[model samples]
Target: MTLPDTPEQTPLTADTVLRYHLCWKHRDLDGVMALYHPDIQYHDFFQNRVLGFDELRDYVRASLPHAAGEDIVHSDRIRVDGCTAFIQYQVTVQGGDGLVAFQSSEAITVKDGLIWRINEYATLVRRNAKGSDRSSPRPATSRLGLSPRQLSTMAQDLEHYFQRQRPYLDPELDLQQVAEASGYSRNQISYLLNQVLGQSFYRYVNQARLQHLLASLDDSCTRMPVDDLAFAAGFNSLSAFYKCFREHTGLSPKAYVKQISLRART
Candidate 1:
């Protein structure tokens, strides 16, 4: 969309780029979006996403909160050539209590006093996960010697193996066995589950077991006892089964069965 015809609506220049950066810095999504042409095309290389204004708005809405920050832009230098402006800036965003600095630039094509096209690139300059300063380097041995990529890959591999082999069906299944089977070190496996997946190894396995138990429950015609069913789903002890069942369903097996039964009848 075009800007209102006013003295403030100058042709594309360094000032226009500064205004755009200000809109982002102030978290003024409306102002930020208004700068785009009605036929604007935005491309994000890292996400490999290309979209028009409608989809662009939705993407920005979802992603801005994660990336937005105050006084984050460096506007000391900007290059303007013809109808195109190239802007260089650094943005510092808060990730938890830590700060992440991204060196960024954008190329804008202006048509008829409005921003028509924008191509942006961002590079991670520094990441401080512990709210530390530049005095110390990011740990090379973070997460107990496992890099973020390695942990992510291990987590994926573990999930894939469990889904395909249903290894949690073995009541005695444990983290060490998972580590061996998944070909990741035991510590790496533990980190993948506890840190990345946000659950203990047993808890992750038990959640899968709970899903299996629920599927069996869905077949209301099954005559199998709940305890037997729990055993078949990899619960070696009655206490573990009861605890996991209550946590997962927020109801006892009997209550769950009754609830589903009533729903079926209704």
Candidate 2:
């Protein structure tokens, strides 16, 4: 919480942290690996795991953003003391009721101009549609070998799989199927959907199905009955389709189709 009143190693610590930050920002795995001290220790409190130098290479690589411009907001405050620096940041995943993110902080101890120790912490925050935020002190799921960034990436990967493969178009689709298809374990996928993104796996799949039907509705969808379209989009039952439709569009299927027709006429 507090640093030295007058720090001597502030400049050296600042330089080391800055380089480390830049290496991460640029996604240079080699550069990041080069900065780690041979005896470095990384403590990830969220995962309840500690990784040493030998393990950090793969861990850091897994934790880096896979896609460019992913939402990682670093704070302006990078505090430094004799040989330690504290940094704060947030990694946001673009889904859920509103915005779901992890408020993450790190304490870095530099030794001999290299990163010798790191203590990392993360808390999950979920913001509802009404603009209120609910946060968990630490994630309910632990020791999963996933960082918050990895969870974010997994969410994106799941979305992409749905978009490209249209896996939700199968009426009998299940979580195990998705897990296998997406190359993630069933538990990992479940946690990302339920805890991080704040929704059930079926709810997420139904949302994809609804989106598929909505796209069809936007383009000459009147010829086919909405119920038929719902079935085509993978809803095995009418009741489920109607609920998903109403929750997403705030209207029954018939009303939505009628509104689309009216827009076409106008």
Candidate 3:
């Protein structure tokens, strides 16, 4: 089906962008896909995925379901330049007494009045009603009788296990194994990581893996290829490793290595 281009051939505006955003929030797959050009290129840099129209459609369909009952909080600022637009928003999902917000920004390119290309990045945040201060001490989970000190100790022990044992380097390492080894229930571990440490299990693990990778980089004698280094650091996918590395260090691996080399010379 062919969508009509704007009569005046005007670039996409905030209104046009909102139509697409609203369609996504409402989980209207057809409406979402209708705004895309037939030859669309969708780039999810975090996933290291570049998808065409068919893959884009499948991804949108699969992802929208997760937003079915969630609230979409859109930033008021939508910046448009020529045929491109930038938008930011957060998808808030219920998490026990609080909410877990996945915030994302998209750079969209429009052609012939349809979305021709898109690049998106996302991060997470946690929020609660009454706007409680996140830095304040958290109350113990009702399910676990452990005091704050006990939870803190468990978090530290878990960190030590992950760092010294390098279980994160195992692509198959999972919460169950960690729990079994540490004598903590999976729920308790998850609660400690999420509620106390303010991160998900995978997020904490990946951060550890990224740190491990950096330590390897620090060893000038290390001769492993960057990809091998990433794998050895326990990242299952190269894309995921790159994403995590960039998120943690604010630079890609190659750039980071170059910076380190220059610093050593200086």
Candidate 4:
């Protein structure tokens, strides 16, 4: 709860929060720390974390946009009421072409010219949900203590890891191996894949495998059978491979190959 202040405190609260926002935009750690009240508490509802001053340094550092062109888009202008200010924004998950994003809001309470408390809430915007014809944001859960911004970074990192390492090419690969190699805990990776990306771990891996196989099929000189290529691309079973392939290409493997051959002949 915030200390009660009259309308006279509105200007001060707005100024302080504007500065805090600029500090975050510029990736200024010390500037952000300077604005925080020593007894400040940051509550992240999405991750269920309640952080203090000392803990906030690392949290803020991880959240600040270190690189230009971060995906955060402000949904509304800052609105201040007495001693508290409100900010709302959305962070688009990377590597999905903006198909997925999280809507986040922050309620900052100012006290004695510094930030006293924060109540942060975020929800994952689902592009598609089972048994529903429409999409919407849901109450996201994360025990891994990752903020929405950090989850966006995690998405980018996972995509980069898949592209550069080609780990999906290993038929024996599992979520645990990815968690270990990617420098994240299984729960963290799982949260990113399931909560934010809206896909199971195995489904993500199979999608990568399918992409790999399709890329190989583009080579006219390649002569491997489709089933063999599927196994080589890390599918453990033919049925699984065919299902993934058809889901992606909307055609049977033989028909897809025939179409590619037709295009080449033309």
TM-score of each: 0.48, 0.92, 0.48, 0.84
lDDT per residue for candidate 3 within 1-266, as digits (tens), equals 44333434334455567788789767798999999889988876545567898776666764664325445567657777666778887654332234545466899877777888898765545565676424334334325533322343465567667767878888888889989988889988887667655668887778878878899999999988889999888899999898888877789899999998999999
lDDT of each: 0.65, 0.87, 0.70, 0.86
lDDT of 3: 0.70
Number of clashes recorded per candidate: 1, 0, 1, 0
| Residue-by-residue lDDT tens digits, candidate 2, 32-79 | 999999988899888888899999999989888886787899965788
Worst 10 residues of 3 by lDDT: 133-142
> What local lDDT does model 3 show for residue 237?
91
List the candidate numbers ranked by TM-score, top first.
Answer: 2, 4, 3, 1
Better of 1 and 4 by lDDT: 4
RMSD, every candidate, angstroms = 14.0, 2.6, 19.2, 3.2
Best of the two (3, 4) by lDDT: 4
List residue ranges in candidate 2 displaced over 4 A. Answer: 1-6
Candidate 1 lDDT over 1-266, as tens digits, reads 54343434434455666787677666677888888779888755433446688876665553343233332466556667766778776554321123434455778877665677888665544434565544322222333533232333344456678878999899999888887887877876665454434457788888788888889989978879889999999988889889988876789999998998899998
Scanning candidate 4 in windows of ten residues, the lowest lDDT window is 126-135
